[model samples]
Target: MAGLLDIAPLTEKVRVGGATVEVSGVSAGGIVAMIARFPEFRMLMTGKDVDVASLVSMGGDAVAAIIAAGVGFPGDEAQEAAAARLPLEAQADILAAIIKVTLPNGIGPFLEKLTALLAVKGGAEALAKVRATKSH
Candidate 1:
């Protein structure tokens, strides 16, 4: 008989550059690790207005880490490096796809809020403050 632990993880394919990459929902533990390692990630999961600049400040390393984690290749430097090579827009798309699988309600609402936030004042500076505040 199959058990709960025996079930295969749910996966989705997303395009990055010119390739379709398969990504899975990150595990609870993986999410926790991300939050711990990059506090800015907590803001993203909040489903509130996220500071894009703050996320960007975390830089390519953080982006790569998130991609690697979602792709079920956590700690694989080659995977991370590959992800780092993708354009920022492609990275965002991939992140959204990962969130689709990770969150029960999907990333639709979150992206909407983010879009609205981007239109507001403070932009990158606000995000910088957010990242700074979370670091301490």
Candidate 2:
């Protein structure tokens, strides 16, 4: 069989809702979530309007490519090597963990809490001070 195909181009940052979303460093499921935005990828997922088994076969290749590309991760050679050794299933599990932590019920609760916090006495002032310090 041929070696893994290069999928570095797919790792480029994507724009969603007027904000840049990084797919780099995300798990296999996360990469699927990102790349599945493409109509072709979506088709691959559901085997809808396409050859299901053939498309599913591409799944491993795509995930492997994304991991190998090291999308958003810091340049850590050891981590990369370790990740490379992981079976595809383990990689997917790690990605799932990342997605769970990073995307727990969207921003609704977070924004609500943030709004409440900023409303508290000295909250806005404290944030302002931090921002001002960072700007210097």
The top-ranked prediction according to lDDT is: 1
Candidate 1: Cα lDDT at 115: 49
Could you estimate the TM-score for every candidate?
Answer: 0.63, 0.28
lDDT of 1 by residue, 1-136 (tens): 9999998877889976678989896787887788788766776654444333545567788888888988998778899899898888888877776766776465456445654785585475655565566556
Residues forming the 10-long window of minimal summed lDDT in candidate 2: 43-52
TM-score of 2: 0.28
lDDT of 2 by residue, 1-136 (tens): 5555744423334333445434444454654554554334443222122222332354554444434433455334555565556655555544443333443443355434654787685486654564455445
Candidate 2, residue 8: CA error in Å? 34
User: Candidate 2 — what's its lDDT?
Assistant: 0.44
Candidate 1 stretches greater than 4 Å from native: 46-58, 106-136
